[model samples]
Target: MNLTLKIWRQENARAKGRFETYKVENISPDCSFLEMLDILNEQLVDKLSHPVCFDNDCREGICGMCGLYINGRPHGPDDGVTTCQLHMRRFKDGDTIVIEPWRARPFPIIRDLVVDRTAFDKIIQEGGYVSVTTGGVPDGNAIPIPKKNADEAMDAAACIGCGACVAACKNASAMLFVSAKVSQLALLPQGKPEAARRVQAMVAKMDELGFGNCTNTYACEAECPKQIKRSNIARMNREFMCAKVCSEE
Candidate 1:
């Protein structure tokens, strides 16, 4: 299959950026999206020109390192599929694909199709984990959590923190990401110890990073590659409100 690519090109984070068009010939329908980019990069190298810069660590889609805005959607047309998992078969021949990076205030573009996602790490650092004592391996059933809650927690835990939610939200809200992180722990018995600090800290850091607030648009849920529900946002709000009110009381 042939494709016309309109990829964003920039020298660096501060350099002026623009879209540069190139034609990709003889692309296999089985090629992963990144593989198609690799072909483009190979052509650029042969011509001694700079190649497009995009993020991709584990091409298998487990790491969520590959975050992209394809055409217009967060991860292309496929439902609940990460950028690395997107295959070229989904697109037709002679398609003009528009590729861009995550457009959010916090995730400033570092170059063409590559944005700094350090803000996510900062939020996690504030409080997105549990503090367990270092020792030998603990038994699996030590916590004794209910099956239903455990399953729900795992569902929320599936979030890869790809930032698609924020990129898709008009307000650039990080609520969906933050909520998934919060709910994954808040539903578990082991996470109860640090639940209060986790919720308040994550949200506070999210605001500090200049990410906007959720306005019930549900766009985040719609764009999330993990299909993490907006209900997690509701759970986070209730948790934050209760934590704040109880602290005040």
Candidate 2:
């Protein structure tokens, strides 16, 4: 199928960026979205023109590095999939696709479709781990955690820090990403010891990094590739309130 792609091009974070259009023909319907871009780049390189730059590692969708705003939706029109998992068949022949990087203040563009996501790293560093000393791994039955809690924890842990939550939000909020990190740990016994500290520090760092507030628009939940629920955001709010209240006591 032949298609037109209007993609964002930026030289650097400080450089002015603009949309550049290109056409690709005879692309296979089975070709992944990144593969289609690769075909486009090869054509550009063969002509001695600069190729488009996009972030992608582990094209299997586990890495969450291949994020793109396609036709105004995070990760194209598909649900519960990353850009690397998107196939060309999702589009119609002769369609014009608009692709752009995550448009958030915290995620500044580096070049053509790549944006710096290290702000997520900064928030994770603030407190997204089980730091308290727990002895060696015990028997699986030793903890005896409720099945419901374990399932929810595992669900929350599925978050890949893709930044789609932020990109989908009108306010560019990172609440869903941050909440998933917090919930995955807080629901487990090993993480309870530092849960209060973890929630407070991570939320503080998220705000400090210039991420916007969640206004309950639910866009973050809708666009998340992992389908991380907004209930995690609610849990995070409760965690934050408890932390704040405990500190005063």
Index of the highest-TM-score prediction:
2
| Pairs clashing within candidate 1 | none
Tens-digit lDDT string for candidate 2 (85-193): 9999999999999999999999998898999999999999999998767688888889879999999999999999889999999999999999999999989988888
Cα deviation of 146, candidate 2, in Å: 0.7
Which sections of candidate 2 miss by over 4 Å? none
Score residue 123 of candidate 1 by CA lDDT: 94
Runs off by more than 4 Å, candidate 1:
none
